[model samples]
Target: PTAPVAAAAAALCVLAVSPGQAWAASADGPDGPAAYETAEGAKPVKGTAGSGDGPEISPGTYTDSIGRGEKKYYHVDLDAKSSAFISAVAAPEPGSRVKGVGEGLKIRLETVDGSECDGGTEPQFSAEGAAYPVADYATRLIGADDECQKAGAYLFSVEREGPETSDPGRWPLELRYMSEPGLKGGPRLLPGSPDSDEEPGDDETPAPVTSGEKRQAHGGTGFNDAGALAKGVWRDRIKPGETRFYRVPVDWGQRLNASVELGSANSPGEYPPTIYDGFGITAYNPARGRFEDDPFVSYTPDESAQAAVYTPTVDYTSRFDYSTNTPCLAGWHYLAVTVSPQLGKFFKSTAPLTLRVDVTGTAKAGPKYAGDAHAAGFGVSDEDKEQAEKGQNAAEGERSDSLRIVAYVGIGAGVVLILGLAVWTLTARRRAEALPGAPGTPGALGGPAGPGGQAGPDGGSGTV
Candidate 1:
C-alpha cells in the first residue's frame, strides 16, 4: 500500500485502541454521586454508596454530587483513640424554595448500631436569603463522655434538613473527613476539648453597656440604622431578621478584632431537643460592601447545654490597597449581627447578643500621592475613585479549566498521531527491503524469479 494509506491504517489502529485505554483508565475514576477514595479500585470497590449498607469510606476528601431527598451514607471505622471530623460543602441551588421554614443540610455521626455519637446538628441559614456554596461541618471527639466510642463501623450520613421541596437540583457535594488519632496510651485531654478544665478568665473586660447604662438606643430598627457601637464590649438584643449595624471609625494602620456572644434566655429543658437557632456576624467595609475573603462567623446553638452563650470572634487587618480593598479598608466599617429565628424554637423571641470591638495599632495616614486630595475615603485609592466616578464594576476572572483539559487532550492526540505515522513508515520500509530482488535477493523486481521460483515475490504470491 501507499505510504499515505499505510499511515491512515496505523492511525485507525491507534484510534481504535485509544478509546479502550481511555475507558480502562476511567472505569473506576472519581466521577460518581458520592465521590471518595477507596483501598481497592480494580476489584472495583464502590466510591458512591447512599444506603445504610453503603460502602466503607476512609478518612479523606471526596468530591461528590447529590440531589434533593437523596441520602448518601459512608461508614468510617474508628477506634477508641481516634476522633472524627466530617464536613460537606455544596452550593445552594438557585430558585429553590422552602415549604415553610428552610433548613440547611444535616450531617450526623452515628455508631454501628445507629446510635448518634455527636448530637447530629444541621447547618443554619436564613430561609429567605442565604448564599450558596456554604461550608457545613460537624465534629465528634471520642472521650469519656461519648458512650458510643466502640471500635467498629460508624456511619456518616448527609441529607437535606427539611422536606425535599425546600431545595432541589443535583448540587455538587464535597465531603471531607479527618480522623485524628489520639495520643497513644491512657486518657488524654485535647487542648480544645470540651471537657478541658480551663475556666473562663476571671479578669474579663467589662462590657460597654453594662445592662445598666442606658444604651444610646440607636434603636437600630434595621440594618441601615444599625446602632453606632463604639470600640468597646457592648450588649444588645436582636429579633428575628432584625439586623443591628454598628459602624466603628477604623483609621488606617489599625487592626480590629470583634466578637459577638449569643445568650440563651431559656433553660435547658425549656425548648424541644430539635429546636435550634443561628446567629450570623458579618463585617462590611466602610462602604457597607462585602470584602472578598472576609471572615463570616456563624454559630448555631442546639439543646446540648454547656452555657447559655456562643461567642465567635472575627479579626481583620486595616491595610490600604486598591486591590482586595474590602477586608483591608478603614473608616466607618460596619458590623452587622442578624438572627435567623426558628419559628417554634427557643430563639423565637428576642435573643440577647453581646458585641465587643477592640482596636489596636497606631493610626497612620495613607500614602501621599498626586491624586491623594481626591481620594474617595480612608482606604479607597485614586484609581478606585476614578472607577467609582465612572460607575464601573470590577471585571470577573475567567474560568478556563475545561479549555485547558481540552488542550491537553489535543496535545496527547497529536503525539499519538506522530508515533503512529513513524511506526507505519518504518514498517513500510522494512517490508519493501525484504521484497524479492529488491537489492540482494535472487529474484528480479519486474520478473521475480528466485531459485525456488514458486511465487510472484519472496517465494510467495504478490497478494499481501
Candidate 2:
C-alpha cells in the first residue's frame, strides 16, 4: 500500500480503539443519587480568610468545599464595560440532614473598598428537610447609577449556614463566573413596567401538551449539567431527598411555562397516612438567580401532586424593571424539581416525575452585544435547541458509550475496506503485467504488435 494510505489506515485504527478509553473514563460505579458535576477542567482553589488576601479567580468555573458556618472568600478582576455574575451551588451528601427553611448557602459580591455590588442571595432547603443542591448568584451590572460600575478588583464571599443539629460535614461547592458584554451603545428601548395583576390561577394556566410521546430526560444535579428540555412532556424517576435540574432555551420575546407532576407512591397503604410537603418546583434565570419563590404542593402517598411556574416574555430591558427582572435574560432558563425526604418514611421506591414544558411567542432578534455573548455562555445556539429536542443531558464527562462504540466500529470497518480495495487493485495490475501479452508486452492492446498479419499466443491480433 502507498505510504499515505497506510498512514490513513493507521490513524483510523487509532481512532477506532480510542473510544474504549472514553468508555472507561465515562463509566461510573453503581448508581446512587446523582451528584453535582463540577465544570470540566474546573480549577480547584481554596478560599481565604480575608477578601483582600484571597486567590484571584478568573471568569470560569471552580470547585471548593465549605463547612458549616464557615465563610470563604475569593477575588476576581473586572472591567467597567461588562457585567459580571458569580453563581455558587452547595451540594450536601445525599442522606445528610438539613433544616427545613434556614439551612443552605449564601453568596455575595463586593468591591475591594467594601462597597456592596449587589445584595447577597441565600437559597435554602424547603420545609421538607430534603438535602439537595441549593444555588444562587450575585451580580455587578453596569447601569446609570450602580455600585461597582468602575470596577478593578472584586471579592466573592460564600458562606454555609445551618443549625447545630444539621450535618457538620463539609459540602462540595461549584462556582461559576460569567461576564455579560455591555450593549454596543445605550439602551435600545426603555424597560417594561411591572404588571400589577396577580398570578393566574390554575384554571387560567396554559394546558400541558398531551399529544406527543413522552421523552426520557434525566436531569442534572446542578445548573452546569442540567439536562436540555424542549416544549414537550419529559419523564424521569426521582428518589426521596433528590433534586433534579433541567434547562430550556428561551429566546427573546419568548415566554416559558413549566410544571412537574409527581405520581402516587407505590404501596401507599404500607405506611402512615400523614401528609407531607410532597414536591417542589423552582425556576432560575440564566445566571442561576432564583426568579420566583419555589412552589410546593401537599403530597400524600395515596395521590399524585403537581406544581407549575409561568414567566413573562424575555426582554433585555427587563433587568431594569424590578418586577420582571428575573426572566429578563434570553438564554437557557433552569427548572429544579425536588421530592421530600419525608416520602422515604412512607415509600420504599422512587417516585415517577413528569415535566411539561411549553415555550410560546415568536423568537425575536436579541440586542447587539459589544462582545461575544455565546463565549460567555449567555446566548442560545442551534446546537442548544437540538439538544433540547433530543433531551440530551449536559453532565460533564458523561456520554453514550454504546453510540461511540458503534461509531468507532463503523469508521474502522470503512478504513479497512478502502485499504483492501487499494491492495486488490495494485495486486491485479502487477499480475496482469506479468501475464503473456499483457500491457508492455508486444501483443498488448497499446503495445507494439507481433509479426505482421499474425495473432499472438494470448489471442491478441498482430499488426493486421
Candidate 3:
C-alpha cells in the first residue's frame, strides 16, 4: 500500500477506537459524593446564633418541626478561606379554623456584632383555609467588603414575625448549610434574583408541557434529600412558596438541561388579577457552586395559568482551572425549585410541576486534583472517593486490555491483506511478461514477418 493509503487506514482505526476510551473515562471519572450525603449525618442542634449559647452547626441539612412561637438559632463557624451558603425551606402555611390576622416568620443571617448577612423578613399566614410552604435562601462569603466577613461564629435566625396568633402548629423547616472555598480570601458577588426583576410585561411566554396521568413520587420533600432522576420528564407537586430540590448526575463533558412545568389556571385566560404566581428555578454545580458572571435563571415569573419551562445548557466543567467562580468538575448537580405564595382567596386545582431534565453529549472527566475529593464544596466521603479511584483504574485497565486485543487483530489482518494484494499484483505482472506474444520478448511472433510488424491469428507476424 502507498504511504497515503496506510495513513488513511490508521486514521480510521484510531477514530473507531477513540469512542470506547472516552466513554470509559467518563463512567469511571473522579466520582464525587452523592447529593445530600451530609443530610443523613447532620446532628440536631437547637437554639439561636446569639446569647453566647447557640448550637454550633456544620455542612449538613437539618430539620425543625416542633416548638411553636419559639425563636430558633443555629451558628456556623467559618475559616478565613471559605464562604457559606444557607437556605431555609419552610412548610406550607397551615389551615386555621379561628379567624385572625395574618402572621409571618422572620429569618436572617447575622454576625455576633449584629450585622445582617442576606435576605429580609418574609411573612407567614394562617386562616380558615390551607396554604402552602415557603423556601428562602442566602449566600455569604467570609472576607472583606461584605457583612460578617470575619472568620468566626455566624448566626442563622428563625423567629416569629407579624402579629402573634393562636395557631399552635409548628413550621417544618428544611435547612441546608455548606461552606465552600472562597476566592482569594475575598467576597465574591452574588447573583440577583430573577423574581425581583420580573414585571408584568408583554414578553413571549414559553409554552409549558402538560403532565400525564402516570407519575412518580419524588424521593424527598426538600433540597437536602433531593430525589435522583434520569434524563426525561418527571411529575411532582409543590405548594405555595414550597420548594423541591432535585439532583442530576452529569459527567465532566455532559450538558444538563432542566425545566419546570407548573399547572395553568382555569381556562386559557390570563393569571388571576389578585394572584401573583411567583416561581423561580436555579441550578448549582457538583461542588454546589454556580458559574461566575454567567447569569443562571432557569425560570422566572414563578406562576402561570399555562405551563412554564426553563431549559438552559450548562458549560462542561474544565479540568485545568480550579477557580470556584468557573463551572468545573463533575458529579451530582443540584436543581432547586421555589414556589411563592398567592395572597388571594382562590383555590386553583391543577397538575403538579412537570420537571423535564435532558442530559446530552459524551461524559468526559474534568481535571483530577489530589487532596480533597470534595474540594469544590461537595461532601464526598472517603469511601466514595476510594471506590471511584478503584473503579476507574479497573475500567481503564479493562478498556486497555480489550483495545490491545482488538488492535492486535486489526493490525494483523490489515498487514495480511496488504501482503496478499502485493503478491497477487507481482504474480499478475510476471504472467503477463511471460505471455507468448508479449512485447520485447522472444516468441513465435518475435520478428515481424511483413514490413510492418503485426500479430496474426496464427501467432505469426502479418503485414500491416
TM per candidate comes to: 0.36, 0.80, 0.46
**Residues 368-401, candidate 3, lDDT per residue (tens digit)?**
3332436444433433333232222223434555
Which segments of candidate 3 are over 4 A away from where they belong?
A: 1-41, 65-70, 92-105, 118-130, 142-144, 165-167, 183-219, 235-245, 249-353, 358-464
Sorted on lDDT, highest at the top, how do the candidates line up? 2, 3, 1
Q: What is the lDDT of candidate 2?
A: 0.77
Instruction: Kindly list the per-residue Cα lDDT of model 1 for residues 104-220, writing each as its tens digit.
Output: 577777876767764354654543443333334444555535656668777887775556446666765666565544533423422221121123332232332233332332324
Pick the TM-score winner.
2
RMSD of each: 21.8, 5.7, 15.0
Pairs in clash, predicted candidate 2: none
* C-alpha-based local distance difference test score of model 1: 0.47
